[model samples]
Target: MELLNQIKENAKKANKKIVLPEGTEERTLKATEILLKEGIAQIILLGNPETVKANAASLGVCIDGATIVDPATDSNRDAYADIMVEIRKKKGLTKEKALDMLNDPLCFGPIMIKAGHADGEVAGAINATGDVLRPAFQFVKTLPGMSVVSGAFLMFLKDKTFGHEGVMVFSDCAVMPETNDKQLAEIAVATAKTAKAIVGMDPKVAMLSFSTKGSAKHDVVDKVANATKIAQEMAPEFKIDGELQLDAAIVEEVAALKAPESPVAGKANVLIFPSLEAGNIGYKLVQRLAGAQAVGPVLQGMAAPINDLSRGCSVSDIVNLVAITATQAAG
Candidate 1:
């Protein structure tokens, strides 16, 4: 079976509840239909009930098994507002302000997850990255022991002759435009966990840089090298190495020549790029040129399973992400 099918199967077994904040969007409604039909998860669509039903009818989509909650009029509004005010009171959030914010599904969705009303959330179809993530950061918060929230992609390639049978985790691809050594270490740890949970792999992390093992001396190389050290200290059980060039990290021949002594050099399945520029560009290049199915920019380090979708994503993308989120929530 394909990776997405495999994920959908696993998600059905998990049977989580995933919330869609962009419930009124056409793509979201369409994906909800498939998710419900397939029993992937119980779904909560956040929008006006009448509007969501009308949209579904207009789109010729059936959201029969999904629950629709109108943030503007739901009975849970008062309880959610109270929760938000309690969580953000230090930020000077008044009950009136919190109630007003709840009118936006983006804010309400994460609140549902935080309140145990939903197992996970998948949004960003029509919302900005910040619009989707800020609520998660504020309400859902980070996982214990994690200080930074990052993003990663599960890169599945058509050819299996490469790293980890052409399955790899590319980290910090959509978040943290730049990272310090500490934040990079945090990203590495979170990504290792993400790979194990979502990709079913024992993570061998490669902290990528332009240089390999002292072959160059720029501060950029030093940053990656330092992050590798910190990640090692933070997660000694993980197989990790760096300041490696991309080739030296994944190609055995190049590893033998350039980083022969490194345990993770050529066997790495988690590629931790030094910055968002490298990660974002690298994933897109592979997706466009290598025929790899880049399945995420999935958010990690949050306490609950909250994912962000590209605004350009198709209905299938939404379906896949909901399954992925269900799997994450299951774990």
Candidate 2:
């Protein structure tokens, strides 16, 4: 709660413009009112103004501060299309096709970010993850020198002694199904940056595996070991150590026995799972069994702070994510 509260405070100070493409969604519209009331951000809702107003009226929510932009009829549509075509010209995109895509609120939102009309975007409620991310990947793309985008979650645990004051960052938990050692290295580096930027933690990252300091032998364990080397080489300043089992990664006693020389072995607050299967299952087990509060699968490594939501997200979920997106934009 303290971490999230700090993030929200940072967001309020950032005063960024966040575009919500699902302007007509009940939860989204409802969240806009809360955001406006708190001054968390300046919001741009993409939809017909009358429909948005009527929907808000029906829902009995006031969205007075939201700038409603109808993507289909906005005067900037032509200019946005021109920017879109220019962005995708190398991919053989045409002006006519770009104009057609701008009709979609999803496409409109990212183009708005790329054109500098908005600071960040949040969507995926009532939409598939692929549909929400496709345009963002095509237009906004990954950050410079980053070939892969990953997801990280801020796991707030019940046991204060376990992590960095009961908080840890879990990565590749929501993206990247299976990655090679190099991609795994990127995930480690990216997750470390996310931990620093969002949680203000000096990330001591542990690359998790079934093995700890060559105690086990397998290709999978070898992959983690190789990735540790790669990630260490990639970011010489960050404390990255790997081929560690989960216990050794976070427990001081276990780390002392298994990886005595590792700088990050005992105090690893950032855990990078070797695969998405392990990451997803691990985070869920901690969230459900250990009763940790999982705050994100916050998408990282994007050029801009675009984010996605589960279709079943609550209004408060929308509000929290917008705050997180704004915080990321501010970072």
Candidate 3:
């Protein structure tokens, strides 16, 4: 939890504006009240102002410090709609359709970021992942020279000997069911950035696979190896290596035997899984079995930070992710 505390401190310094689309959602409202009290980040709640206040009052939480925007009645709705039209011109988006779309808080949140009204967004408490992400992908898109948007989790384990003082970053866990080598490379690079910016760790990335330096050969292993190469080339400044097994990535003895020549094998703090299925399974296993704290699926590689949340997330989870998003926006 020191990591989240640190993130909160960083967020306070950044003081970035972050929009919460699920303003009427209980956890989101509660988290917004806490964020407002702590001055962790500027809060923008998207909904009908009166309804948002009534919900907060009913829940005995005061969200007086937050900015409440009713997308349906805001003066900027016309401009946001026009921006949407322009962004979707090729898809033949109409102003009327864009205006109607903005009524959905999920869509309004991203459009706010796109128009510089807000720096980032956190949603998905009362929405599905696709609904939360579709507008983001359509509007915010990916960061420059990045064609992929991936999710990364900051894994904090009870045992201190593994990873960077027991904290490792795992990626593509909540998005990208499958990827080609190029997309995998982007995941690796983006995850490293996330680890550094959000977790405050110097990232030594390991492109993960079943094989350790080709001990066992397969197309999947080759994909990981190729991704490692591409990631290294694309980000020459970072220490990155791969086709490493999980043990080889974190165990010095296994790394010494399996990937002796690799700089990152024994010391990796960022793990880029070969697929979403693997990433999801690997993180959950460690979280439940090893008693590790899994903090994210922090959406990365977007032009602006727009993170998704699990519908089952707690108030603390929302607060922590908003802090992370603020830090990402700062970077």
Candidate 4:
């Protein structure tokens, strides 16, 4: 499906409030406008209200100050502390700890979502991944069935190279540095489910490695093989395979010659890497060296949508990620 069409679908389903941590950037401000104007959901923008409005006005974007949440305001502090305390009760966080979070406005967004004030959050437009994720782990935590929070990058392309006319997802590139077979399997399942929700299709997942089946040998190769098996067993309704090289995973001719019997040999829409080193370097190669628009490093497996924007992101980067996060939340 087209990117804008996907965004429209997400906007249609969003009914809960969404929070933006750093709402001062041009792209984020514009995204806020898109959300409000589309009537997607109620948006709570973090930062000073005057500063946010000033930034939006300078960017030729008009944002209503009343709709934006200012954590710095005295009126919000007491409520913020109370919300934090309530949400962090499971973590044994004390009143003092909750009060301390009120000092930093960054903590307010995720905390608000955790406290039921908002349904989801979109952050990291101007912050580091660590900063964007800290609050999520502190409050939002993980979904009931998920143990570790993982991430995936959406590769939107219009090239003949992938031999397809659609976008796809590649995962574990930004989250888990190293994963066991179980974790790899879980990543594949989560990524596939995400694909189904956003793309409206059953994802064909390829657990990518340097080897094609048993053509090569290494502990890592075995991990991919085992992960593939686990994923197949866990998600019997989904098509998946592993121990396949990138070429065999995506190239029709190569896949036909390599693993002709595998259902996902050539038509995989999602790729799961066994290690963070491979996932990170591989996606960067595709994005920077191969000319694909890498829309993520988008965080997955969380109960709510909280994405980490690259620190060097541009205004457009912020816009796309906000849209991606909204899609995640809505779906």
RMSD of each: 1.0, 1.1, 0.9, 2.4
Q: Report how far residue 77 has shifted in candidate 4, in Å.
A: 4.5
After superposition on all CA atoms, how large is the RMSD of candidate 4? 2.4
Candidate 3 lDDT trough over 10 residues, lowest sum: 192-201
TM-score result, candidate 1: 0.98
Badly placed stretches (over 4 Å) of model 3 are none
State the TM-score for model 3: 0.98
CA error at residue 81 for candidate 2, angstroms = 1.2
Give one digit per residue, the lDDT tens place, for model 1 in 51-163: 99999999999999899999999898889999999999999999999999999999999998888999999998999999899888999999888888999998988878776
lDDT of 2 by residue, 1-331 (tens): 8888888899999999999999998999999999999999999999999999999999999999899999999999899999888888999999999989999999999999998989999998899888988999999999998889888888999999977899999999877899999999999999999888888999999999989988999999999999999999999989999889999999899999999999998899999999999999999999999999887768988999988887878888889889999999997
Q: Cα lDDT for residue 147, model 3?
A: 91
Q: Which residue pairs in candidate 4 collide?
A: none
Q: Rate residue 172 of model 4 by lDDT.
A: 88
- Count of clashing pairs, candidate 3: 0
What's the CA RMSD of model 1 in angstroms? 1.0
| CA shift of 319, model 4, Å | 2.7
Q: Quantify all predictions' global Cα lDDT against the true fold.
A: 0.91, 0.92, 0.91, 0.78
Residue 326 Cα positional deviation in candidate 1, in Å, after optimal superposition: 0.7
Worst 10 residues of 1 by lDDT: 157-166
Per-residue lDDT of 124 in model 4? 70
